[model samples]
Target: MKRVLVADDASFMRQMIRDIIEPEGYEVVGEASDGVEVVEKFQELNPDVVMMDIVMPKRSGIDAVKSIVEKFPGSKVVMCSALGQEALVMEAIQAGAKDFIVKPFKPDSVVSTLGKVLEKDD
Candidate 1:
């Protein structure tokens, strides 16, 4: 089972992701809101995968990704973004995010994309 760190400002979104992924055998090692918490938790939890939201307070996802990827080169991060944030999403990938998931998430897309990201990392 892979450990995942879920980073989103919205409590509901975090819970929703936990609900979807945990049942599929992924352990949510940590949950965080905002960019600073994401970075802090990433260091503390050291999860295999990170489900990160792009638009966040304190540092923003792009900024956090850049710093996190630099420090944890082996980290596999998949960004979560609302629809129409294509530019930011591309920036996230450039910042070393393995992939991304759009908002209003579907269970299949979440599981499938996570699989692809983790597979590539492996």
Candidate 2:
């Protein structure tokens, strides 16, 4: 089972991601409500993949991704963004996020994106 760290400010979004991935055989090992917690939890957990929200408070997802990728080049991060945030999404990709999923998320898209990211050699 792949270990995933979910990061989003909304409680419902976190729960929804958990609900979507759990049944697909992914284990949600940790969750973060902001960019700071995202980095902290990432160091502590070192999960296989991180589902990060781009618009997080404090540090922002792009910054957090850069931090994680700078330290751990093998890190796999799939950004979560709202529709119309294409510029931020592009920035996140440039920052080393493996891929992205748009909200409101569809279960298949989430699962497929995770699968694709996990399939690649880090």
Candidate 3:
């Protein structure tokens, strides 16, 4: 099973993603409530995928993405974004995120996008 690290400042969002992603044959190895935690948890969990939020506290998701990508060149990060954040979304993609998902997430979109992104190198 694929292990994912879920990161979001919103507790509810984290739970929601966990509830959906875990039962769908993916293992949610760890969670992070902020960008700083993202770095810490990532070092500990070393998850296969990281669902990251852009506007996190302590560190923005963009910076986190850049940092993680620099440290772990093969890491896959999919930014979790809200509607109307086009610029940031593009920035994230440029920063080396494999892809992104809009907020008010749907299970199908999440699963499909992740599948495509994760399978790219395979």
Candidate 4:
């Protein structure tokens, strides 16, 4: 099973993601509520993928992505963003996020995106 690390400041969002992915055979290895915790948990858990919110506290998700990718070139990070944050999403992609899912997530899209990202070669 693929292991995922979920990072979102909102508790509900984190739980929502867990509810969506767990039944798909993905194990949620960890959760982080802030950018700094995201990076720390990522390094500690080394999950197969990271679902990171773009506008996190302590450090933006874009910055965290850069840090993780710099340290672990093969890191698979999928950014989470709200609507109208296209520019930030693009920046996150440039920062090395594998893909992105907009907020108010569609369950199918979330699962498919995670599947596709996991399928790619590191």
Candidate 5:
């Protein structure tokens, strides 16, 4: 099973994502409530994919993406953004996030997007 690290400031958001992905055979190895935690956990867990929220305390998701990509060149990061955060999403892409999903996540889109991103590695 592919491991995943979920980063979102809201506990409910993390739980929601966990619920959506876990049943699809993805192992959620870590959950982070902030960018700082995301970076720390990413280093510790080395998960196959990171679902990172765009806005968080301490460090923004884009910054976290930069940090992770710098440290782990093969890291696959997918940014989670709310509607109207297009610029931030583009910045995240430039920062090396492999893909992105908007807020109010649809289960199918979330699963399919993650699957596509992970498949690109093969």
Candidate 6:
């Protein structure tokens, strides 16, 4: 199974994502509640993909993505943003995230987007 690192300041969001992806066969290897923890967890867990929230505490997800991509060029990051954060979403893609999902996630879209991110060549 593909391993995933879930990063979100909201515990409820993390739990919801875990619930959605776990049953779809993705192994949620670790979770991080802040941008700093996201990087730390990514290094420690070395997960196949990271589901990162854009508006995180300590550091922004875009910054975390930049750091992670600099350290691990092959890192696959998927940014999670709110409905109106179009600019931030684009910034995240430029920061090396493979894809993104808007907040209040739909299970099917999440799964499909993640699948595409995983399928892309590094």
Best by lDDT: 4
Per-residue alpha-carbon lDDT of candidate 4 for residues 78-102, written as tens digits (9 for 90 to 100): 9999999999999999999999999
Q: Which segments of model 1 are wrong by more than 4 Å?
A: none
Question: Candidate 6 clashing pairs?
Answer: none
The count of residue-pair clashes in candidate 5 stands at 0
Tell me model 4's lDDT, rounded to 2 decimals. 0.97
Residue 43 deviation, candidate 4, in Å? 0.8
State the lDDT at 95 in candidate 6.
93
**Candidate 2 vs. truth: CA RMSD?**
0.6
Off by over 4 Å in 3: none
lDDT of 6 by residue, 1-122 (tens): 99999999999999999999999999999999999999999999999999999999999999999999999999999999999999999999999999999888999999999999999886
Cα lDDT tens digits, model 2, 49-104, are: 99999988998999999999998898999999999999999999999999999999
lDDT of 6 at 41: 94
Q: Model 1, range 81-115, lDDT digits (tens) per residue?
A: 99999999999999988899999999999999998
The residue ranges of model 4 lying beyond 4 angstroms of the native Cα positions read none
Output the lDDT of residue 18, model 1.
Answer: 97
Q: What lDDT would candidate 1 get against the real structure?
A: 0.93
Clashing pairs in 5: none
lDDT (C-alpha) at residue 31 in model 5: 95
- List per-candidate RMSD values in Å: 0.9, 0.6, 1.0, 0.5, 0.8, 0.5
Model 1: ten consecutive residues of lowest lDDT: 113-122
State each model's CA lDDT, in order. 0.93, 0.96, 0.92, 0.97, 0.96, 0.96
Who is ahead in TM-score, 1 or 5?
A: 5
Residue-level error in angstroms, candidate 4, position 79: 0.5
> In angstroms, how far off is 96's CA in candidate 5?
0.2
Q: RMSD, model 5, all Cα superposed? A: 0.8
